[model samples]
Target: MMYFAPYIDASGLHIPSYTDVRDQLLSDARSIFGQDIYLESDSQDYQWISVVANIVYDSFLTSQAVYNARGPSTAIGSALDIIVKINGIKRLPAAYSTCYVTLTGSVGTIITGGVVADINGYEWTLTTPISIGSSGQATALATCKSPGPITANVGEINKITTPTFGWTAVTNPGTAVTGAYAETDAQLRSRQAISTAQSSQTVLEGVKGAIAAVSGVQRSVVYENDKNVTDANGLPPHSISAVVEGGSDDAIAQAIYNKKGLGCYTNGNVPVQITDLYGVAAVIRFSRPAYVDIDVTINLKQLSGYTTQTTTDIKSAIVAFINSLTIGDSLTLSSLWGAALSANSVPNKPTFSITGVTAARHGQPLGTIDIAIAYNEVTRGNVANIVVNVS
Candidate 1:
């Protein structure tokens, strides 16, 4: 079964499923790994924290009565000693992150306390301070970040119990350095290039394997990481070195997600082809990037059809047919239907036959086209785009 799926509801785009949770975890993983936090394989770390704060006037007066001849009993009533007013009291429930101050105050000082705490959970106490006869300032307490060991990187994704494919280690072939092959700057560049290629191969293979495992979809490659020797012919590095699981290692991955409509994703990497609808099937490709080209092929076939439609006039007929399916077209077609002469019909269809998906640029919203159209196709199906604005 799929781990989770993101679904929308009436409560203002509620991510009413576990996908939000898992995706959040994935986000945390990226946050932890994409930094300099060195991590040892198969190890875990733990930390406990404490935070507290309070507000008071004439704290010096609260000091031990024993300091002066005025014992604890003498503190009770000493001519009302300048008449101090008790400040407001703000109670904290165990430990929560966000807080508000009724009065401007220093959380770092005056108000104070602490308790053992965890990142996701903790204990904290807050204080409220008041003015003392124009001598005191009204204030509240707030917390700040404390620098400590926070960076964490888990093993690479899909690295389950020694998965089949992954990045492989390599050493420069030149004799200059232990792993260095040659002294020339060209050689150094060559060494780095080959190492990079090897790593890309490992990751590409892993991704292909993953897509291959998914049913009803095919995988193909549009481009592969490549390495070329300048001024001479040399065998590229045999092993893959590093593939940017997140970014920076290579051309960042590009993808676009449309939650309001059918989801489409496009990445140079493709999935394994799925041939069986009744039984499990997949599509996959093996590619080597040390060269210019890698062959990729992906296709999703209808094992069974859904509805039936045959029309003499493509527009009216297809519209009627698509109007028959369960979909909304707040989106316009990706392109105006190019009237293909022959009309056709597909029957016994599954819920959605995802023909293809292109991944969004990993980090940047390269572009967006909002389409406001609904689509059903007999000759050519409807497509959507994130245009200037659907409105």
Candidate 2:
């Protein structure tokens, strides 16, 4: 006599299968009506029993889902949204890519609400009311019109869309600070875990947590040098260096100022002035991670079910894995094999066998050796640079 019931034990919630539910319902029917009663598959009584069993199974599934939603790690969608509120954090929305473009034109020419286009045809809106300097040039921050991971490399944004008088040309001198899509559930969950360290007794951990909590901040690493002299990494004594990606400069500076220990010196490339409640101003500094472009070459021997799409997927996967690496994380050539193979979602059968893998810095000769990333540098990979040789 099998009984169908959901139960909670040390292993957590467990629900019986639909087959068990159906069998139990039939058993109950026979116990009430004699065992000799007709309950064939086509019988009205059997159909009614199956209906009740299905409804009970559905209710059990719903109950199980609700139970799992109570924990942040297993929650998803709206459930995850509600759970993260307990940590005083919300999902980071998509952001626009930004770049500094130098406008070369007549001096004192004011361009308000000017627009420019990248070589890829993406439109970027310049900061308003920019007056050309006496050197016949003005540098202004331009934000992409469309949000999310838009990129414009140096010399790419050269088309002036809003053609103001004396505005002869436009171009970005450096790579755009790429934007991001809406934070995924996994990303949010990880951030929530880091945010818990905000109240840590260790000041360094607390400072790191506070910076991680800043809105629009994608990734951050904190390094501290507590000795009486400068350390090997060039950090000043009793100083901290934060290598951060994303977020506004002012917001990151404020977060660091609020949580860092008193008398601690900060070291980095970007500096912002923060005014304390006492009306005293102090300079806080942090580094924006420098990006290193990596080129990869993958040779593959095609297996069953391999297609042109598989090659594309393999390239995309390799690029994604490279870009997801944190600052200062080394790029191991062996790891790329797994990244390339992950493109095959099917179990047991693989789509391709990687014959060889090689990588190098952009414009450098590809090799099998691991690429060393410096403390303030992050590796970036473009699908265009990932060459997949498929047979």
**lDDT (tens digit, per residue) of candidate 2 on 117-207:** 9987889999999999999999999999987666677898999999899889999999998886688898888888888889999999988
In candidate 1, position 295 carries an lDDT of 12
Q: CA lDDT of 143 in candidate 1?
A: 28
Give the number of the best model, judged by TM-score: 2
Q: What would the per-residue lDDT of candidate 1 be over residues 149-171, giving only the tens digit for each residue? A: 11111111111111112211111
Residue 99, model 1: lDDT of: 26
Model 2 lDDT-worst window of ten: 1-10
Worst 10 residues of 1 by lDDT: 46-55
* Residue pairs clashing, model 2: none
In candidate 1, position 76 carries an lDDT of 33
